[model samples]
Target: MKVKYWTCHSDGCAANVHIDKNDHFIKSHGQHHHIPEPEQIELRNLKGKVKERVITETSSITKIYEEELARSNLSSTALTLAFTAAEG
Candidate 1:
């Protein structure tokens, strides 16, 4: 079975997970020292959805993006960051 390793994004954090070919959790290591950033996680997921729609659908990218953002309840900070990332 194929294995994939997922590592923490935070600097100096050791938290990680191992997954099998089917994306089932195999094991985990370490722990996060800080509180979870749910908004950031949500924003990341929203971006992924928008990207998938952009790739598979024939709709205008602006329309796809507007629809996704409209459905999501991301914080002002997250929305600002998303637009900034898209602009840059």
Candidate 2:
């Protein structure tokens, strides 16, 4: 079956990728693409496996973003007010 892989955009997840068959792409938690070689099936599989590892290392950045957002406590309304006051 064809398989696809996706890496997490976040920088801290050690195994933040997910991979699966092109038909079952989302099920794998990775990305989706068609596998293209009967002879190179092993190599394609290895690529997908590596993507899983990279994703895990990259996911931690999400937590950092969330934590910082929580600490800032700057809501949209507050930001708008601050900007408007500055303009005045």
Instruction: Please give the range of 10 consecutive residues that has the lowest summed lDDT in model 1.
Output: 34-43
lDDT of each: 0.89, 0.45
TM-score of each: 0.72, 0.23
lDDT (Cα, tens digit) per residue for candidate 1, span 1-88: 8999999887888999999989999999999988887777878899899999999999999899889988988899888887887688
Alpha-carbon lDDT of model 2:
0.45
Badly placed stretches (over 4 Å) of model 1 are 75-88
The collision pairs in model 1 are none
TM-score of candidate 2 relative to the true fold: 0.23
State the lDDT at 63 in candidate 1: 94
lDDT of each residue in 1-88, candidate 2, tens digit only = 5556655433443333444664453443433344333323433443445455557666564454344334444556544443454358
Runs of candidate 2 exceeding 4 Å displacement: 1-38, 58-88
